[model samples]
Target: MDIPQVISKQAAETGEMGQEYLATGKQVSMRRWEQAASEFGETHCREYETVGMLISGILELDLDGQTATLGAGDSWLVPEGAPHRYRIVEAVVAIEATSPPARFNNRDEPTSGEA
Candidate 1:
C-alpha cells in the first residue's frame, strides 16, 4: 500500500528553474518557486506538460509565440513538447505541477537554451 507523505517547506528539494520539489508522485510532480529572481528567464521545451499558478508577483510567459503577463492568482499551462519561455517581472512565489512526473528521466531540465 502507498503511504501518505508530508514535506515541509524547509525540507523541499531544490531543482531547476529555481524551483523546489514539493512532492513527486508516480504520474505527477509538484514544485514551488519561492521568491524566484527577476533574472529568471529561459527558453526551451519540455517533455511533460506544465500547469502553474502565480501565488504572488508578476510573470511574463511566451508560449508558442504568444505572450501573456501573469499576476497573482493567475494560472497558465504549457502543453508537452511546446516551445515556451518566461521572464520574471518581479520576485515571484509560484506553484507548478507537471504530468508524467517531470523529475522522471530528467524531464525537468531544459531541452535547449540557457537561463
Candidate 2:
C-alpha cells in the first residue's frame, strides 16, 4: 500500500471505528479510540504486531479466549497474527501503534504537523 508521506502531526485518516495518525515512513501507524461503552467489536487476527497504551476509560480484550481488562496508564502488546477481540467497557481514549503500517489505515494527503 502507498502510505502517503507526512511531515508532523495533522488531520489523520479515520473510519467508522476511529482516527489514525500515519507516519510518512510507512513503518508505523497510530490511532486513538474514543468509543461509547455500548460499542462492540468483532474478532481480529492482525498480520502486524501492536503496542498500545490505555490513556483513559475502560477496555476488555479477549485474546484467544483469555480476557483481560485494562484501564488508564495500562499498556499491552499484541503479537502479529494473534486472534483478539475487544469491547469498549467505557468511553475510552487509547493510543496504539502498528508495525509495517495497518491495512485499515486511510489517508488522503499529508499536511503540516500538529506540533
Candidate 3:
C-alpha cells in the first residue's frame, strides 16, 4: 500500500489535532499530532515498537512507572508491550513512528466507549 504524507499546519494553529501519515505492510506506521492541553489515555502496543520526536511544544510521557517531559528536539523510544500515556501541555506537533504498526482495534469508533 502507498502511504501519503500528513501535514498539520491547521492542527498546529487550532490547538489539538492528529493525523496518520504512512503505513508500510505491517512493519510501521507514521503519525503526526498537534495537541493543546489534552491527555492521551493510557495504552500499550502489544507487539510493536514506538518512537516519537517532539517537533514543538511540550509532552509529558509516562512509560511504565517512569515519567519524562519532552520538548522541541526531544525524542523517545517505547519498546513493545510498555504501558504508556502522554499529555500535551502546550500547543505542539509531534511525529511518531511505530514498527509492526500499532493495530488500533477501535480506530473507526467515535470513542472507546462507542466500541
Ranked by TM-score, top first: 1, 2, 3
TM-score of each: 0.89, 0.73, 0.67
Q: Candidate 1's C-alpha lDDT? A: 0.85
Q: Write the per-residue lDDT of candidate 2 for residues 32-110, one digit (tens) a residue.
A: 6666785445666776788899999989888878889999999988887787777789888888888867644432122
lDDT (tens digit, per residue) of candidate 3 on 24-45: 3456767777667777664544
> Candidate 1 has what TM-score?
0.89
Candidate 2 versus the native: TM-score?
0.73
Model 2: how far is 90 from its true place, Å?
0.8
Local accuracy by lDDT, each model: 0.85, 0.70, 0.67
lDDT rank order: 1, 2, 3
Model 1 residue 55 CA deviation in Å: 0.4
Residue 74, model 1, lDDT? 99
List ranges where model 2 is wrong by over 4 Å: 1-10, 22-24, 103-115
CA deviation > 4 Å runs, candidate 3: 1-17, 23-26, 43-46, 103-115
**Model 1 lDDT at residue 53:** 98
lDDT, candidate 3, at 108: 20
How many clashes show up in model 1?
0
